[model samples]
Target: MIVHIIKKEIHFRIIKKLCVCFQLLLIVSCQTDDDNPTLPVEDSINGFWFSEELGYILEFTEGNDVVYNINTAGCSIVDDDFELEDFVPSLVSANDLILTTDLNESDFEFTRLSNQNPTCLPDQIADTDDPKVNFDHFWNIFNDYYAFFETRNVDWSQYESLRDQVTTDNFYDILEELVLLLEDGHVSIFDEENGIQIDSGFPKLLETFNMNLSGDFIIENGDDLGDLFGQKATTIVTEYLGGDFEIDERDNILWGLINDTVGYVNVLTMAGYGSDFSNELSTLNDLLDTIMNDISASGVSKLIIDIRFNGGGHDTAALDIVSRFMDQERFLYTKKFRLGNTFTEKRAVSVGPKGDFQFTGDIVLLTSPASISAADLFALCMKDLPYVTIVGENTAGAFSNVLSHTLPNGAEIGLSNEVYEDPQGVIFEAVGIGPDNQENRVPFLSTLDFEEGIDSGINRALELFSN
Candidate 1:
């Protein structure tokens, strides 16, 4: 009963060495005279700029070349070289350089370091396939990059103590225990050959929902859904709506009008929209275009977005759906990342309507504890809209983007490194976002008798629309 959301591709120029390398030469030397005012000045960036927080040193040369040195313990120091394209320099200054790129419209500041050699110490883990080394490397990544230590109340030191007890044969189990302490649903470990080997805290909630129902039951009678619960739930919802409905099988959206006024759309999973992130986003936008156009043409006065069983997906896909309902650009939330051991400054994230078919009518967002990750973010963003009301249970609390890193053993580890907060600066990492109307408890699809009445959540939404 594993539900997977495709991790969003992180486009931070600082994190992507290849993009940074190409952009660095263009950015450092291509400053126009109008931009800088001083022409043909000597390069002030020629020297080592050390980031004590990241334990890395950047060396810029007069030749417009850059070298990056990563200081990791037990592993040989890693260096990356980038050659700058030919360009005339307009100005040079001793002030800290702020690198800006279109990859993310954010400024990365780097200061000059006076120390010829910084005191940054490398991790004691070697860059090898050894189980102990792999384990230590994995631990170090979280220690250095994971942002929600204090917020999640995770004591990473306790896990370090257990390292000595782990053997090659039992290391995977030990690692799972170690990560589960963080309680982050985004954290997982997968081998290229064996698929997912560890999912620390994600399966606990699924277990609570009794996710072991058979597939035949889910498809035939659409019942007994354990983990394959969403399809049956969706079927029940469509039947309750009772209109000429259409299910976009490829996009997994079921849309129709309820009582000739309320437009209903039930989105199952946020993943599988396309093969890749870009294609997926395009496909999602296209689907939204069709849905919004139909709703507009049908003259619906209200809309219902059901994400009760959404297991999350790329954050961009969530934003894509949200954009159709927004009329103006507004700040939705802020994202923060870990630098060294401390969290960095929060960056604002906002979205606005992109297409002509923006829905201005009242919106009812249906959610459940199963609505997670990107789904949680969708709820957070929509809740701020004046016309939107959230119903059903609290959403799955995880909201950070899952970042994947490959170990020397060819196994990949994914973890949440960013922290997202609502407009009021409230963090909902462990505790999910509560609905405006909680009277509607999420009905279990396995035990539901739809003939009796409509889903409590849907009824509440209808009641709100009537009022």
Candidate 2:
């Protein structure tokens, strides 16, 4: 249950490489140039830059750079000999710079900082390995940024009692216990150097599939839950799909026909498309162009889009895949970032008819608790469409951009820092996005389902279209 759940397609905004990765979506940086603290500025790239998304204070000097992992609790140097990977500027405005980094090779927009945060100042920087200091930083990181304590029905204060109990020997144990109490799929605490990665969400994710990868997710059997991705793909291809059946090289998408009448497309993930990460959207659009063209040519009257195992990726990729199924524009959902005790203004998100070819036929969107983050966003937007009927179980319900931080001891932590809700202001944080019809609900990889080679989600689509 504690195995670090890493995101295959790294979200550049988080401290992904610092610990491990977690599947996530992106959001606009929370700060503006106007929010910068007033100080002197250099017209060159060598200056202070701040990224609320990455939770880092970046300082660039002659030929060297320094990165300070920051949060409301405190700040600490990530390492004595650390530098931002491939930190070359791609764009520079008055006080803004877009720099490409090794995190998925994505260009990130960073706001030029005039001065450092008070907590990150040299004199105030937390540089000790004290377990209590690390504990304070860890607890405060959540106190300041976690957005779902109320929604998840967990009292954050409950952990205050453990603050006094923290010790160097029990530091990791205490942190792991606190992490599990939060019950968030996006939350993770890790010490890469110590080979310790605690994923609070992995057990539940495995439980949704009835897998025993953690000996606690569901049953007693022990198996790598990650294998289920390939197993599920193999089962669908060998047992149910036909026609131009094919899986892309990246294994992110699989498409074909069900009985050569109903269209079938399973998006295993929303991002990580091609050779170039910077042009990921372009690459995906081109692929979508080809797939939509084929679907149009195939003349399938109905479709089943199975995103049951999509853990998440970029939100853009999620929307790109779904827009091809719409007949018109739709106001999808809204998101708000976590401020101190409250949140920022809600931002509306929408999608319109996209791509040269559109599939306006009936669409059955198969979802499960395995569908998370960007996948949750995909389900939320699709739920608003009249032509699409969501089937299967509810989504994983963790919808937010993951914000990363580091403890005083250099341990990396990530937590949900935003909340996404439908257009009507309905949030599905812990409860998940439910199916429009569950009569067709089926365990995709359960022991019985797997042994019998069953994929009732597809069978349900066939049953619905036949009616």
Candidate 3:
């Protein structure tokens, strides 16, 4: 009987080994071609790539410009001039050319551009298409072109696989994966028609709830919260939850009630100059009114200004906000950094010989992993003050701001044009500001308790002020 059992076990082991070998072979068969073909190095490129979507052919001239030649029913049309310096060849097949101005040439893939189908936009999305065949390509693009390339610290291979698996599951799932794939504040996916927005704000803010992106969050297992942002882990619980379930006009993400207190403000960019551009005077007027008339009357001594979602609006906003707190010139905090070859720009806050509203109370500003641009400037200005306490994780640290522009082919590129510094001659461009108190609510997951909760940074602010 023992001899018969041993023979049977050996046969089963052989079958298992064969199954493993077959799986390895199947994976290898599905891999993309890695062979780099040999080509004659050219001095310059002057050729065309076919686009079927816009019904035009884009050709490059040696004079550093791209011109569109319209083709209707395969017939030529009128010509329009364009610029192609930002046009990096999409390497798909063997037909794409990587044109370099400095006499360097490489070959990438070239696909006949498809017609601009509006339905392909994520909101109106329907079925599987060729472009949806891969998320790995987008991941590669993020690694190549993201603003904070070296600092993001993501595992490229894993992110690529994760996004690829969920691109077509549903609307919210795809967006959640995309945000995680590109966590940097500056990196965003935009739709041309709906405008560049993440949260579609429409429905009125609600009260007393737990919400997630997948839809109306169902409290499970005796009222225990399940998934939060994407399909990751169980949610952090909350007490007094209130907000709205609105869709932002931008058509990005679905907003639940828990998303109300966190306002959605996009800086759009942060590369301009001068004090007048920041619109600081206006923001301060509103803030001061909130503190004096609203908060003080409501018996609320503490205030939480959420700048974590801010994407660097203007430098003047930072300076103007700080000016409100500077009682003495010695107490003023100021710093400057060189902006390329132009005049050196002041990055911190100082006493501007003005006080919009002087309140002898404590202030706590909530920052996060995404607070950037002018908002970052504001947090840094209040970093050293006794009355002001910054709560949350470090700033987004996107110090080197960019001026971005779009190409005719719908590809957008940004150029980093300036440098900024913190007080005492310290440059904090790539490096962000660390909070006085490090507490945070992870994006898309933690339910914010307006009353009391461990993960609530706003509660931390109130705690600081109450003490």
Candidate 4:
């Protein structure tokens, strides 16, 4: 007799909002009874299943409940116990059980364990509230899942010696020091109760150039650029570009025609486009449509996309912006997760033209050490396009989807777990994308110096168009 499995319904809305990763298991309750219930021929699902990728364990109980534990360290474990009801499981093989979850349309194949219980589950790190335990937990998470230890040149094992020295008073400071060692703009530690959060490393990198490329600096100095360029430039009001979307004129974006032939758009940040990711993408698309439409209609022969100080936001936003310049679908990049000691297969990420308008003119993308995360990703995608030339400094090379995890001590930690590569299979995590032409390169923030008022990167771009 064939046994059909029924799954419990779970809403995707709640799942999407969850801070936790979706490595869930769906189990069916064992049924026995007055009316007689049918069961699968094999009851091999009752055992321990471990996921080294996520550092979690699942204990399938005889009563049909699963004990979920997030094991960051050998001693520490975060327990999240839940009961699975109204679901059926099928035996795909002697040791493989196929668990299906409803509504979310997700399924996982669990291999039955020969051992009933694992030895690692016993030591639950009793006092997770202890500062030492929390510190150890934080360090262990990175030791296990962080993919860039060698790339960042971090000696993670040495942190074990500091565990005993960390106290409640110095926990935050020590943790910040440890996190900063990664030198990743995407790595951060937040303890709201303790009023501690690690600042992005991108800004510190900007200081090396003796300039400030932040949005505030740009707005403060943008109006004065016309005086610097003299007859070569004109500062047009942002409203003249014609977009219905509301953006902070001071920071979000700045647009105008240069020399009556080149169109310039400086995108400050990928965030603040909207409240959520979807809305942010929609708002960005609308903003780009308006800005690109204006530039295309003006018959500009060249375009410059300035992201020198952009810190980044959603990757979807990056793809959306790049799509506006593409006339056809283009392969952008690929992403892969680390499974055990090795990485999983690469998944291709592509972008195609969006909306009715497209920019086909020669494009120059400006970069700096401050151009980070999604901003760096934007440079990566645009680098593949024939018309786009990258100028300015190398980007802030933190390019991965940030995964946020909450420790038992209530401190939040974010790190990059996935690896992103270009179509050529080249990874640009620590080393950012290089400029095609390195002429007249100015420090990112030095553009604010209207007295000198000269941007080597911009000048190089202007020269390219002039030739």
Candidate 5:
């Protein structure tokens, strides 16, 4: 809604002075009317166009104008143009060239940019010579073809203008504005190539923060409920172990603490280490073995695993963890969605510790909205595990393993490529893993804002543990 212009100067050589002068004259010739604007008239647009993505300048010739020039393939001439009869009025106030053709008694709009500025002014007239005419023309075409016009409430003209000025750091703000225009949760901006990398679910990420286990367990340290849960779990594990437990700093894994009372394993992320970045199934198996040992020795009544900011990695680790809690070899949980009314089947089968490997004791887990990917895999897999309850908000639901590619014009599009389903075949595609016990923000702590009393999800899980 507000406009500001800052100028900077750069030095460059002047060449082909005659040709440049002649081109300027022709553009001036096409400026037939500044006043008494009525019927459409021929406009001239011939100049250099530059986009940061291409990292080069494009030259537009006066004759045989090319409407599109992909960075990799170079430029091409216009094959067809469409005219809009009543549509001309809508564009009259904006400074943009018009090119059109008639097809099936319908009108389409195009632009011829020669020497005009790419940014649109509220009431200013565009020059006849601008290369951005094609850009504007194609934008309008795509906007109509997709019919995704209600993406936002910002003025269309202003939106186009801001896009023309995409070099500024405020590009994120511009992208946010554009996202608001689409009004679709699936659509988001990804400008990694341009040094503006937006995450898969940035709209939500913008409002959330990721936290980890910080400092030693202390009741005096700022009423952090997360620390409280850890302290409680530690106390239970220590009592059963007889000897005190040790926090493994080498791996940040809390171990040597559960002496037959409960199994305590810390999962930093679903994604694993190394360049290949795969989950370490063997490591997970060893942790499960420790838990199984604890339960067997001390008749441990509960197991607690913490999951926070786990963006998911290997599927095998998920199976390993769930196998320790289940009694059967195969069980049902969920299904996944795919294109063409097709759904996939998912079965949770235990490959390790055959026969009576299931833990009858209560299963408790910690979570946050940031727990996504294969982390979702773990939560979803255990939704029905014996006595298993999750404490946290619904996950990011950014599943459906999607692939992303960029358009020739630098637009990025993401399409779902992989489908993830629960054992019974219920796919949680767009549906995130909702906690069995929901956690809302904590109040009076004034530190946390809750729609209900004290982090409902955490409190519910604590209540379950207390009972």
Candidate 6:
């Protein structure tokens, strides 16, 4: 592997390529069956509630509240600015607690810990250049918390031997090789102080997109494929939607009329809606409400919802947007976590109708490899509905809460520690949510397509609703 300082902008770009999945995760925990005996709501109100998905143990106490970021290496108190009311306490069972947060409508489910314990104390690992220490620590984290070794068909046990040969000189090389073996988009290693970051799956995905969709045309021009693709996607909206649209203040969502009866909504992300976390959900809802009213009033019988360019954000945001299309309550999806050999019970997730107007019209949801975590979740749930037709490529296939940990050498690492599935129990981890309509494949734009002013996805969607 190469040893170099990845640019600061490059690092942020990686973060952008990935999704802000943990905020949705920040709200969920290990959920078990309802048949388990229940505890009185008052008894389970306050204590250490473990969010297995987030790898955080939230200490909800009287007068004092705290959150701890945990991994096998140790525990660090997270300085999250969440308040008491942020977690409106409710009991699904004696051991199961839910926090109805104001950030999104999705409930934060937490499992009560029998005892308050962290993997170990922070600083327990010596802050030195000990390759073996860091190596072991890194491997152990995945051993204990990584949820998809079996699903990805990678042999974790096979990598154990690589530890003996790892050294100061070849540590990063070995690490890079290891990540490539895993092929998980959500798995990443970060050493900010050293400016070293290793992402397991994104490079391969981008390379594939360049080969398949863009035909390496952007690469031939010596421009960044991802960056150029985003610009073309934005331009495609203007090319197809007549260059007139309204966007939220942050530009996270864009909406306009493709035609009189066909309206379009392009969601770029599921998060970053407000200055304060307390009001984030409200800010998002207000924007969606505006979009909803416009669609309702226009009497659009066919709606094209484009999440092809989305970087994953909050689960609540995804569901909230999905809610605008639903006329009634419905089951959305399910998620769970892994504990060594065993797995947590499938926790069913559902969403209900929201806002003043719901567009229960013919819909086409466009997708791509850029559709990440929450974006993948959005596609998975939306495909379950009767009226929604997915008309693009598969999503990014990475749909778990990103769990992070620090090494003894102060290097940081993050990976998926949970599992997410469709409503019928199909795991979409290594494989993303694919389109339901297989025959008419509308992929993201190629450089050639952009040069010629063709927006195949929208054109194909328009054909679906033609009178």
TM-score of each: 0.72, 0.83, 0.40, 0.70, 0.47, 0.80
lDDT of 4 by residue, 1-467 (tens): 00111111111110012011111122332223224333353455566655445444456675544443244454333334444434455555566555533211123345556763343445543336688877777887787777888888988888878998999788888888888778877677766787776744533463544344444333222233222222112212222233322234334666777657888787766555665423556677778888877777878888988787566665666777778889799888888766656976777877888888898789998887767777888899988788888878888788875655557776657777778889998999988875855463555445454335455567778888888
Query: lDDT of each structure?
Result: 0.61, 0.69, 0.36, 0.60, 0.39, 0.68
lDDT of 6 by residue, 1-467 (tens): 00010111111121123222223134432233366554564555677777664456766666566666555655545433445443345567777776544433334456889777645234442356689877877777788788888888888888877889999999988988887777777788777687787778767666656764544454432135555555656565667677788777786888888788888888877777887656777898998889888888888788899888776766677778888888788877777767656777777888888989989888899988778877888898888788888887888888875666656676766778768877777888878987765665766756656667677777777777773
Give the Å error, residue 243, model 3.
11
Quote the RMSD, in angstroms, for model 6: 6.2
For model 4, give the 10-residue run with minimal summed lDDT: 6-15
* TM-score preference between candidates 2 and 4, better one: 2
The residue ranges of model 5 lying beyond 4 angstroms of the native Cα positions read 1-193, 203-263, 273-279, 283-299, 333-358, 406-431, 437-462
Q: Please, what are the lDDT tens digits per residue for candidate 1 over residues 1-467?
A: 00011243211111112110000112223334355444233546566554433333455665544333232432223333444443333332464544432222233345676644532233432346677777766777677666677777988867776667767788788888777777666777777475446655545554444432233333222132232343445444456666467766564677888778888888766656765433666777788888888998999899989887676766667887888889899999998766765678899989988887899799888887667777888898898898988887678778875655445465656677678899999988877775754465554343343334346667778988999
**Model with the higher lDDT, candidate 4 or 6:** 6
Tens-digit lDDT string for candidate 2 (312-335): 877777888878987888888878
Please state the error at residue 335 of candidate 1 in Å.
1.1
Query: Which portions of model 3 miss their true places by more than 4 Å?
Result: 1-183, 187-304, 308-312, 329-353, 408-410, 429-431, 437-455, 465-467
Q: For every model in order, what is the number of clashing pairs?
A: 5, 1, 18, 4, 40, 2
Model 3 clash tally, residue pairs:
18
**Which of the two, 1 or 6, has more TM-score?**
6
Candidate scoring better on TM-score of 2 and 6: 2
Candidate no. 3 TM-score? 0.40
